[model samples]
Target chain A: MVDVSQASGAEGPAISMRSRLSPYALPIFLIALIAVSGIVSPAFLSTSNISNMLLQVAPLGIVVIGQAFVIILRGLDLSVSSVMATAAVIATGFSGQNSDVLSILLIAVGIGIATGLVNGWLVTKRSVSPFLATLATMIVLQGFRFAYTQGAPSGNVPPLFRLIGSATWHGVPYNMMLLVVLAIVFGVVLAKSRFGREVYITGGSPTTARLLGINADRVTIIGYVISGALAAIAGLVLSGYVGIVDNWVGRGFELDSIVAAVMGGISLSGGQGGILGGLFGAAILVVVFNAVLLFGLPVQLQIIIKGMVIVLAAAFYVRRRI
Target chain B: MTALAPIRLSSRLRANQGVLVVAALLVILLIFGAFISDRFRTTSNILNIFEQSTGLALVSLGQTLAILTGGIDLSVGSMISLLSTLTSGLIAGKVSMVLPVAIGILLLGLLIGICNGLLIIWLRVHPLIVTLGMSAVLQGIVLLYSLGPAGSVPPSFNFLAYGKVLGLPIGAVFILVLFLLVALFLRYARLGRYIYAVGDDEVGARLMGLPRARVMLTVYGFSGFCCGLTAIYLTSRFSVGQPYTGLNYTLASITPVVVGGTLLSGGKGGVFGTLLGVYLVSLINNVLNFMDVSTHYQLIAQGLIVIAAVSIYVEKKKRV
Candidate 1:
């Protein structure tokens, strides 16, 4: 069984003194993967291949940031994948061949916010468990996307939006930049903000939080809403990357995000984890997929490997928690 | 006496079957069916509903057991897919129909259920995460084995599916048998009581030294076994093993389990309630089809029904 690493206090100077070495384990795994791949292909370390890895991981990284928040609140949101799909569809629809770009962008953001709010309300007000509620939402939204687009996906992302996925400004891709920005925002929120502390309290022990006058339900709802919003943004970047919108956009994304979050050392039972840890987890996942491709493993085998990693990560997380 | 009566009423409410909500929904759909088309009232259409509901009901029983232990088995769908493919593929391979099919399904189920249990218990992980991963792994394995759908059911199996027994479809008989077995186990078995105790509170059960690990393993194992059984029957009914089959089983299974009044948190509900829930869901779907509502509206309606059922569960619990 895995052991929980050293802990940082709930606040203040105690946090910085705690070693940031938790991410070291994940990075070592990545290096090992890279090393193994290099031995096989000799071209695994090429600049282009490395960039490809980052690009592939960026969409999932963004979504994992949201997943971290929800899990930290001791809740899970299964709707992020569908929220991503809905957002991508809406964004693509508005980004018609001829349109004012700004208005379309606004609509996309608005739709994302609205989706998050609905998910938040259902879980908070209706008292539905996050699991079942989000699942229903996910299916319903998927149905909507499928119905709207029929079998074929229509519309392309605008050139501007696509740039974020494709362009490299000063040799750094826009998606990578977005990831960095999200990381900083999430770091500040989780480490410095009052709301973040409240989230932890809620997840650590809901009954205690309620006793302490904390609105645990509200915090939980907020956590999911944040996750939903982040997933929407991730969808925007994803659609940009692909240059097209499809009904199946972000299919099984929730699974990926959960895997990333768990592997990154974010506990599934919630209350203790960092956003950067999740990003590293996402990186490790993408690298594994890349290595599999490099080795020419069949897609089915690749799925099996991915599934194995997910189970391993979760198993480790649970052991560490206990 | 009045206060005592209210207390008894509350207990009954707490222990009450979730079938009524499902039944009420079915009646509503029936009226809608009558209003939309006269064909809905036809005997064959009703029979078709029963036949189709059979496969889902069988799988839902497995789902009910897993959920009863305060966990889920997403792999049930994938297990069904794997077993269906195996059963048909074995028959297609000119293997003995009964033995190969039985062994194949059982092996797949045992392997998957054990993995889930080991991951959750030995690995100390959440059931959802382990099962989710297992689902993917199982799906991949099925894909690897089948390569592409290539299997056919033997005539004997289909006889059980399409043939009549006591004027009831064989599929319906299978469902009834499953219900009876589950009801009996929950009522009489020591391990079954342990399952209820564990679901009510894991820590408390452990403190009581109730063989928590064994209970967990057995419940999950039982779920896997039932899933395998359901897969065989489903393949028989469809007459073709589909590699990409059971795509919808995850939701289809859960809808009945949840609507059956089993608490998602575990430690409540039973097989009989699941039977009613299964029929109610299938009946609603049938009635919707009869009304000729666009297929698009069907999912939305299903989603609404689950939400409504959970909402009622929550409200009832909140009141007590």
Candidate 2:
């Protein structure tokens, strides 16, 4: 890592060097994981295997995008798992034949927005704590999923839906393409947009943001809305990829998203992290996840590893945690 | 300063703010229950409420202390489940082994709590993340230990949960006594007061020369201990220890704590309001069951109640 202190100082030689690797430092770890996975099982490096991993990463990566935003605001959304499940169920249950895909996607996104709005409203207007508020939504949503699914959730994903999950064009996975597009768009929005700057300001220091006339509540609400909408998209993608409607689908993504965000160097203390960094985090986590699967580790042990990662990553990266 | 101290001190109690609200809710629930069914009005059924709520009451006590210190122990649910499986698996229906095993489980819980405290302090991470991570690790351990209910306790041990003292459930009565003692300790004790001080302002509390590390460690330890007690009680009640025993507890425990008027930001809540909160939750469940509501809807109802109660509490706190 380039020493920021020296690099930013009058060291003429260092001043010209842009440490691109230092920024997305996670890539080195990602490369090492790929190398190890390939060595452990030669088939792991196969294009098919790599694409399969990307398919898994896509939904989780999108969810991480949303989770990263919330983390940037020093808030949490335990409701994402429920939100994701609800979205997936709504899409397949309501779609019936998968005609008019826009409507189903819209409805799913609508649920996400409404859920996010309620969460934000409760936190800002009603003064409920972020985690508890979302947790309530999570509970209510779980019941809703139970009630809605009945025995089996309605309908199946359309063949066209596989375009995003499985179909590839020019040797690139479609889901990866969509994810790349999302990363660029949202990444730019977070890094360059006025709203993004406001997010950082409000999150980093509410008092200072207030002095600067930023509406912290508005930023918080919008952040949640984006998170909710993105979570819905991720859920829809997951459900579509699975091609079935099950209540347990996307069950633990809330925690996964947090882990990804933390791994991506998104500080829980707020006002840091970017979309690209989060994607890297998502990629790293998914690679590790695939490694666990390839090694045939039990689900129980996978859970232990995940928990350990969240703790270790947060301890390493989250400044001002105390 | 002396003249205002008691008033200010009383105001600082978390349970005071929502004591009346939860009490009022309980009264309304009781009346509603009475009107709803003859089954609900019976003394046996009334006692049943306390008995069923004992598990939550025990778990929430530890949660209360954790929240009081401006941190939360998400591990308690997993701890409860893990300890339950261990307590039952180790005892294995042997009377001679029960005492030793139960004590060992409680000590293990304490050890986990201390580990949580050490991790938070050493790593300089919030307890939420540390405990959350620990919860996952413990949950995996539970799953690895048993896919289902693993073992049983002797019939004689069942009395811990089922036995009554003067018509009240043993678990409920004992838990009530425990709550009262903790309330008194929080009110009259120095260490107890330090909990509130740390929650209200950690830096200020440290500047006051309080032992913040000891306070954090002990609070988490108490939370773990409470989970241990709950596990034993659950094993006694169910006769078998299950992996999913405390599945809903992590979230369920917080409902009573926050609705009891404890701020999520920590500080300013007491166990008394939590006692009322427990009763209120029990009453709500009882009323719902009497109404023949689906168990699925019961989750929604509980969650809705949490949201409503929290909103009202937040409004009340802000006004103050």
Top-DockQ candidate index: 2
- Identify the CAPRI category of the predicted complex in candidate 1: medium
Q: What is the TM-score of chain A alone in each candidate?
A: 0.89, 0.90
**B1-320 per-residue lDDT for model 1 (tens digits):** 87799889877865774566566767887777777788887877778889989888878887888888788888788888888888788788453667766777787787678768877887877788788888888888989887767677657767767888877788887777768977898889998888888877777788888897787788778778878877777777787777767887888899888788888787878777788888888888887776676667787778877778777776322100
Candidate 1 clashing pairs, residues 3+ apart or interchain: none
Per-model CA lDDT versus the true structure:
0.78, 0.83
Candidate 2 has a DockQ of 0.56
C-alpha RMSD for every candidate: 4.0, 4.0
lDDT of 2 by residue, B1-320 (tens): 89999888887554465777678778888888899899999999989999999999999999999988888889988899999999899899999999899899899988888889889888888888999899989998999999899888899989998899888899888988999999998888999999999988888888889998888899888888888999999999999898888889998898898778887777778898788888888888888888988888888988898899788877322110
Per candidate, the number of residue pairs that clash is 0, 4
- Which segments of candidate 2 are over 4 A away from where they belong? A1-24, A320-322, B1-15, B315-320
